[model samples]
Target: MAEKIDRQEVQHVANLAKLSFDDQALSKITPQLEEIIGLFTDLQKVDTDGVEPMYSPTTEVNVMREDKGIRSNQREALLKNAPDTQDGLIKVPAIIDESEDGDK
Candidate 1:
């Protein structure tokens, strides 16, 4: 059975999503929404008794490497490219206001 999506339901969904649609747009989108619901209803009739549930569509497995401590002496080389540095560390301008207490 095809489910019908009324203008009120569409408007309610729009309001939930913080969207505003005029009468023309609402009329146009209602049919599309109904069609999508009908497609889902059709999908409910499919049989998948022996099908395995998939977390992802692809069959790729993640290969993990053993954690080995290897240090590089590239700090001095990287520090040379920095635009601003302080006490052997990169310095950036403060973005947040620390003076403002949690009152706001």
Candidate 2:
């Protein structure tokens, strides 16, 4: 069945979406929008009794490995590749904000 839609309702939607369509555009869109709504209404009429609701289309499986602490290379070995380091720590320039106290 074709769903009937009011022109005012479409105009209200257009206003919300910040769209300004002339009379010709409104006339063209109304029937197309009605057809899409009708198709969705028809889809709701299908029987899905006893069928499990699907949260995901694919079958669920865990690919995660067990959490365990493992020994890694020392801090010196990791820092050796850094372009610049100071006092055994990675150094970055301090970012000063002029408006730091304005909001409070």
Candidate 3:
């Protein structure tokens, strides 16, 4: 068996992920993480000699819509509902800086 997860290991992982936690939060989180690791350790001991692995718990399938070509005069009506529009398209907030050269 692998070595158990300790408080220092958790703190190291938190530091690597750029997470800052005070002592009280770290104390609370350490045990919860330890319990999770314990659960996984228990799971590793379960017998599965003849069992088929279950990939998904539910039998539900995606109900995909049919891809169809549409011809419409609804462009004007649709743009009416938008909070902002530009060049006949809905204008959403940009996630990145746009260049003056219009390279975006």
lDDT (Cα, tens digit) per residue for candidate 2, span 1-104: 55677677789889999997789998999888887887888866778899888888888796988898888858898888887899998876667665786866
State the lDDT of candidate 3 residue by residue for 26-99, as single tens digits: 98998898888787787667788999999999999989888998899899999999999999999998767666
Worst 10 residues of 1 by lDDT: 95-104
Best by TM-score: 1
Any runs in candidate 2 off by more than 4 Å, and if so which? 1-3, 48-104
TM-score sort, best first: 1, 3, 2
Error of 2 at 94 (Å): 38
Best by lDDT: 1
Q: On a 0 to 1 TM-score scale, where does candidate 1 land against the true structure?
A: 0.44
Which 10 consecutive residues of model 3 have the lowest summed lDDT? 95-104
Evaluated against the true structure, the overall lDDT of model 3 is 0.85
Runs off by more than 4 Å, candidate 1: 48-55, 58-104
Model 3: residue 51 alpha-carbon error in angstroms: 3.3
Give all candidate RMSDs, comma-separated: 8.5, 11.4, 7.9
